[model samples]
Target: MKKFLKVMLVCVMVLFAFTLVFGTSKKDEKEGIVIGFSNASVSNSWRVFMVANYEHEVTLHPEIAASYYTDADDKPEKQIADVDDLLVKGIDVLIISPAVQDAVNPAVEKAFDMGIPVIVFDRKVTTDKYTTFIETSNYEMGKAQGEWLAKELNGKGKIVAFSGVAGSGPAEDRWKGAQDAFSKYPGIEILGQQYTDWSPPKAKGVMEAFIQQFSQIDGIWADSGLMSWPALEALKEAGRPLVPSTGEQLNAYAKFVVKNNLRGFIYPFPAWMSRIAVQYAIKAAQGEKLPKYIEIPVDPIGPDEIADYVQMDKSDFWWVGDDQMPEEFLPSFD
Candidate 1:
């Protein structure tokens, strides 16, 4: 009887030890380094490419055991709620492209206060509570475009500007930068400036109005291909000659420039920034120290080199700057 009791006690002890070890291991496995991505919206081709790039990048890191994703549909309230929900899910890291600058501040600050590393990219929040900000300078992008246009016109022209969504950080910064450049030349006259909300249709309508308002438009300045391409189409429909313009590194814009033999400047705002953002998230999750700001470099594609960036075989919605993604992962509207 004594031997049996001793054996039973030893069995219970071993069982308890096994349960403790395996239970902790299971919990760790279930909770391993979860990442949350809160995107602003996928309303446009560029945003669609960005989300796709992020999804593909996550697959490359085996250590990233799980991920949560949310799209706010360009709504500030929805983005705030999405961030809150991600926090409740116990995510170790949060990556966000904000819908607007000031509206998402509280949610971002909360995540930072709770010790969850926050990474902001693409767009920005007003606060500096994020672990890192990854972006190519929108201001510089606009300034470069403006400077090119100014020089092309010999520091003078009757030009109209098309900006992206109003109140957006990118739009405001780019507009300001372009304005600063234009201010340097007294001969330059800005006929008008309108916000396109980054929609091709809206840009077309605005350009049509500009065409009617101004009898002579020497140059065109647009913040992105989303607007620039449609604006050009408006000019074509109106039976006006193509003018020197500035646009982004979109395949459609490049193709258009090549087909029309248009003189233009193409500065790429790469969608692959999301891929870099994911890499930073992984590093932050591993408790690595990172710089507070990471600015991806931008290079302008001149008329001489625009043909090199054109992918005639690709769909009109494709962005040329997203070469970092595999061809299979690239977004195509066709």
Candidate 2:
């Protein structure tokens, strides 16, 4: 009986040691890599689709144990705080879409300094302390749109420009590119420019004000459909003819262009780029090397190609470039 009791004591000690070793391993296995996503805002339909894409992609990666996300509601300060909060949550990788170019740089740099892999997408930060940047060329998009408008107007027209949220990377870069393009044509006269905040109501109001202020508005240079569609409506309401305009790859914009036979240029800033960002984040977490920048190519849709891209069946909020997304994730009018 004494020998048996001694044997039992030894077995208990071994079992406890086993639990401390393999049990911890099991817990770690259960909680796989964690990811943190700091989103700027879902203020527009494009951003809404982008966020949905990110969420759906996370589910596809079983190795991702958990993901934490925060929306800054378009505030750079809030975005900075959100990133800090995500970092404190012990995420293995950080993915951020900054609210503005310059204001969110410090937070991103801090994450990099902590040896955390950072993936910046859509918008960009001024600092180079990130793992990778995933984006299409906003500058090219703007330049193409401006050149198209110039050709349509025979390099001479009184044009009003509409841009997205001020100080944001895309907005600023695209504006700069468009200005550069317009500068090439000495005949192109810019009557006025306004930041539309990518809101249809606000765009409509701005367009209405432009109509009231400008006596000869010949062309409209809108960075995206968010403003172009509403601006068109404003023109119609004021009994003005629809002018040649530039917009992005939005289903509603395509449909409106096709239905109205309006001459327009559609350039895509694909929402699916968010999915690619997630792919890069997972790769970085798994100790794989990734390029510092991945530039997705974009092709502009001209008047001849507009009908092929228009999705009359889909909701107006649908972004046409989200074709790669799962059907369930696509926006619906119903």
lDDT of 2 at 125: 88
lDDT of each: 0.83, 0.84
Q: Candidate 1, residues 1-334: lDDT per residue as tens digits?
A: 2243234334433433443344345447774567888888776778777876776787677666666777787899999999999898778899999998889999999999999999999987789898999999988999999999999999988998999878778888888889999999999999999998888889899999999999999989999988888888889899987888998977788888899999889989989999999999989988999999999997789999998879998878788868576766554454
Give the clashing residue pairs of candidate 1, or none: none
Candidate 2: tens digits of C-alpha lDDT, residues 56-122: 6766776777677777878999999999998887888999999999899999999999999999999
Q: Which ten residues in a row have the lowest lDDT in candidate 2?
A: 1-10
Model 2 pairs whose backbones collide: none
TM-score computed on alpha carbons, candidate 2: 0.90
